[model samples]
Structure formats: C-alpha cells, structure tokens
Target: MLRETWAEIDPGRIVDNLRAIRGTLPAGVKLMAVVKANGYGHGDLEAAEAARQAGADYLAVAFLEEALRLRAGGVTLPILILTPIRPDQAELAASQELTLTVTDAAWFRELRKGRPAPAPGGRKLRVHVKADTGLGRIGFRTEAEWDALVPWLAAPDIDVDGFYTHFATAGQADTAYLERQACRFAELMERCKASGIAVRHYHCAGSAAALRFPGLALDMVRIGAAMYGYYPPQLTPPVQLKPALSLHSTLMQVKRVRRGEYLGYDNAYRSDADEWIGTVPIGYADGWSQRMRGADVLVRGRRAQVVGKISMDQLMIRLPGPCAPGDRVTLIGRQGGERITFAELAVHIDGAAQEISTALTDRVHRICANEKEVQCPWSSPYFQPHRREATVI
Candidate 1:
C-alpha cells in the first residue's frame, strides 16, 4: 500500500480557524487570511476555499505564481500578493484579477506600464500600496514617496484600492515600536490625503496587531500565523484557531540494538542498553529535521524518542519494545492526548518555520481532510477529456 508522510492538510480545520478569526475581530475589521507559501505548508486551493467560505474577506499570498494557482483552481475571491511582483508577470496578474502590491512610485510605474486588459467580469488590475515606514524592507521609505505614488495609483487604468503597512514589533509587550510604526503609517495616510488620493481601504495591523491592539484593526487585518493556530509567544491567540496540518508516517521496520550499539551517521547516538528500535519512513526529506534526533514522536499513543541521525529518506527511533512495523508516528498535530507543534520543531531543528516549509521534499502525500478529489488545476483540458468520468460539479 502507498503510505503518506509529512504534512496532511485539514480543510475542515481551515474553516474552523476562519470562524475563530471572524469571532475575534470586531464586526468592521475585515479578515485577510494569508494563504501564501502553499497556505503556510497546508495546501493552497483548499485553504483558500475554506477560508473564503468561513468568512474571510480576502486572501494574502507571497508570490504571483501562488496567486495564479489559486485563481486557476477556481478561487474567485480576492487575493493580495504580499511580495512585490516582477513587472514581467503583471499581465498574467491582471488577466487573472490578482491584486498587486506596489511599494513605491517606480514599482507602480513598472506594473502599470503594460498591464493586460480588464477581465470579462473582474475589475482592472487592483493594487494595494504598501508603506515600509519602519519595517525597512519593502515599500516606500518616506511619506513623500507614498505621496508621489498616489496620483498614479489612482489613475483610471489602475484600480488602486487600499494602503497597508507591516509592523516589526507588534507582538511584543512593549508596543512602543508598533505605536510608532502606526503613527508613521497614519502620517503617510494623511500625506496621501494631501495628494488627493482617495484611499478605499486603510490597514496596518497583522495577526499580532489584531490580537495586541484591538483599536488598531483597520479596514483589513492581514492574518498569517494566527490562521495556523500560532500566536506570538507573549500574545494570546485572537481566537480558537486549530492547526490545520498533521504529519504521519508508518514505521518501516524494527530492530533490537544491544548495549553500546551505535546508530546513524557519524555515530551520533549510541544505545545505552538493549533497546527496541523503530524505523520511520520519513526524514528531513519529509520535513523532519536532523536536529530533532532526540525529539519525542507519538507511536501507539506512547512517546518514543527519535534515535541518532535523520537520514535523507528515513529515521531511527527508540521505542519502548511494543512499537513495531506499521505503527503510526505523528509529527505535526495531535496524537492521543499529546500535541506536537511546529514551534517545538523549529526550536529543535535550529531553523525557522519558513525554512522548514521550503525544505520539505515531494515525498509527502497530501490527504485532504474533506477527501476532495478536485481535478488538478494545472491539468490541461485536452488530457482531461480522456480520463474516467466521475461525479464532478
């Protein structure tokens, strides 16, 4: 039988998380669920549809390709690209009705120069102006730059709709820098007013800001991590967002190691005594980290410590005798009464969650929580006509 490993996404959990987000925010604050990076390692199309159905007003992605994937998947709701898109991709962005992020006048000019025609039903290419303020990464550095971009953004061809900024320290207890960044954003908004730009939607709060400062919630709040059931260490979760991912792998085999037996590359871990070893068919290739060699994974509702090195395609674990081949190992999400967290994995792996997402290989099979078998968006219609017929809406 084909086995599944690593992340498995729960579309039902996505719906529940969106409900939690809706409950936390005030009636006026629109929720923009960030579904980028493949919905933070969860599948994107399902995540987007679930989020939209759960009352999310918008979706936020990191790149144009991701946005395009969602669009191609029949997601008709609004999606905002977080990163500055290359001007070369503007036509596809326009045709697909994906929102573009313009950080400066030059960036706006580049995108607005040769955009595609308005889609049949969708509006012209809509864009949101991002203010760098104090984030120091993307967006206009000063109020003047924002002011200069207003007139062009408000042009007839460009559907300039909103203004947003990022917060560097919104989750901290201090809230001092967040306040300063908010102030700077406010000043820039004022400058846009002076330039006669009609701002349709004004936002600056992210997930942290939405939880930390209720008053700062503007027309929209960009929620990324909170949608994944993770809030900052200090800040409380705005709502009861359950994590939407679970990773599982079956034990490939079992072995008994005598005392002083060494395991794995470089002989990283040695057996202290006669130990029952369980080998899981997962590794760093499946998003498990080598740094997590000593981390506990749930097997048969019991904790088993991972032994020695995490090989490219497999990992050895120390189980308490009873674990055998075909035993399920839970990595991300709950097993029995215990919960394994990505944050915990990050600490053990000496890597960030974003890095973990990028490092995941293609071995992990995605099992949708709702068991959706929707046709792949990337599949061509010519090939589709020859396949078996089934129940499809």
Candidate 2:
C-alpha cells in the first residue's frame, strides 16, 4: 500500500479468538459476532468473514447500512442491526432480509406507520426486542411497556426472532448491579414464556458479560472485544485471545537535536543534550491521541518515549541511538521481543481498548496480511517504493 503507516489485521488471530470465545459457551449456545464500527476498526468484511469461518452463528452490525454492505459483499449469514432503524428505512431493511431491533413499542408502531408494504415473496422482517433492564439507554424500560409489545411482535408481518438486553456493569467486579439487571431480564423472559411468545433467540451478553457471566449466555452471545483479543480489566476471559490488529508505521526521518533545541509544536519538548529523534507518520488523526505523548513505543525491541506534542499527522519519539529512516516502528503491537498492547495504551489515555480501536480513522490503510489484501480508504491507488524519505525539520 502507499502509506507506510497502516493497520495490520490478522484474520487468523480473529478466528482463533472466536474459537476461544466459543469454547466458553454452553452446549447449544450460539455465537453472534459483532462486526459493527468496521469490525472494531479492524475491517468489517474481513473480520466478519473470519468470525463466520471460525463458526459464528450470526452477524450483527450497528445500522442498516452496515448490514446492507455485508449483504452486498456476499455475506449470507443472518445479519441483525443492533440499533433502531428509521421508519423510512424499515421497508428497505426488510427487503434486504435484515433483522432490526425494536427498543420501544411506541417507536415500533411509529416505524410501521410509514413503512411500505413488504415486497411480494420477500422475507419477513426479523426483529429483536431489547429490554432496558438497567442500562437506561434504549429499549422497553418497564415491564408493562415490554408486555404491551409482545403481542405485536408476533404479528404475521414481522418475525420475532430474538429478545435481548444489555448489562451496564458486567465488566466490573461489583456484581450487585449486574445481578439486578440479569434478574430483570430473567423476569421479562419468563413473562414472554407465560404469554406464549416464542423467541427463537435469547441473548444478554456482550463481550464482558460473555466472559464474566457465561451463564447469561442464553441462546447467543454478542462477541465483540473478546474476539479482538481484549477484555475488561476487571474481568478475566475463560479463554486466551490473540490480538487481531496492530498499528505500525515506518520511521520517516531521523535527526539529531542540539542541546536546548525545541521539538514539535509549541516547543513542548526541549533537548537537555544532543539527542536522537525519530519521526513517525501517525498522529491524533490516526487515533494516536496527543494524551499518548508520554507512552512508550517499541523501537527495535527497545523502549522509546514519545516526547513532543502529537500533531495531526505526525509525532516525535526519543530514540536510544542513531536510527535511520525506514526502520520499523511498533505503535501497538509486538516488535523485537517487546510488545505494546491496547490495554497499555488505554492506561495512558484513560480509555478502553474498544475506544482505541474504533477511534482509528479511515485514512489509515487496513492491510489484511492473512488475506493478502490491502483495504485503502484514500482515493489514490496503492503506491509502493523500495525506500522513501520524509523531510527532516
């Protein structure tokens, strides 16, 4: 690819991680791979393919557009859109054989009002009813609200394929809130059963819940972060996961800064002595935040500290010795027997690995090493040169 700075995606690792997560589920439990947000910024179609090959029973995305993209890409697995779809988009979603989520009964009625009649011979619109046990975001918040929607869910026009909920604290050590949410969800499921509503799937576990509370893995578990080799710090995964994505870049330039010379914008760093500095072609725009200035990156297996203020498209690192342009740099991955993880970077930025992965911008090329394909968002064709140099300031 053209840019030396790109994300290397290991689909094999994703497959292994999916298998690992699958092993934790009980007999007959299904796995729903969450490939929304571009597969957690690892490339949606690639990750989805890997997960499916590794035995994912279903695929889920955040919106109808994502589901349609997967359909266009020839993905035949049952696809569910987790977020609520617009009333205008309902007919199109159904026509594409996509599953939509219903958060509130009133909203569902409104969605059907303007929704065009289903196409002749088209598949029924599958739907999953979400209950807001305690997340307080979307879904039916009270029992009366959820009960009112059950009868309508069984309408001939719609297929009530699933029922689900979300846990707000499944990853935390405290189980009080988690237990409460689970109890509420259980009560709702019991109500559904008593009302003779057949839900083909019942799920309440995301990555954290799947790992921390495997018992909550009812009919399926929506696997996301765990499939990418990360878990909440407070929770331990039953199976080991391999990181599927790594951020890498080449040393654009190397120069020596005189003692007392300033580095980067605002002169945020001053050299105490003549020091070697290496510039990398990545910055805040690439999801490498300015708050990561003090974080350490792997340079030839040695630790190099980010010294200067991170700019929009570049950042400076203090090198141990003279390093030349074209040297390999590891921003979030293993290199030369050393490793930098998203969790470590999260500690520096006070965020989670999911946040770090999803924050990656489209400008960065996604190189699927296993597939031997390069996914580029830039308009320019892929360019490659044996060697290239950047201007040294």
For candidate 2, the TM-score is: 0.91
Cα lDDT listed for each candidate: 0.73, 0.82
- Tens digit of per-residue lDDT, candidate 1, span 233-325: 445675666665667788888888899999999999999899999888888867666777888888877788898889988898888676667
Worst 10 residues of 1 by lDDT: 384-393
Off by over 4 Å in 2: 115-123, 371-393
Off by over 4 Å in 1: 4-6, 111-123, 350-359, 370-393
What residue pairs clash in candidate 1, if any at all? none
Which has the greatest TM-score? Answer: 2
Q: Give per-candidate clash totals.
A: 0, 0
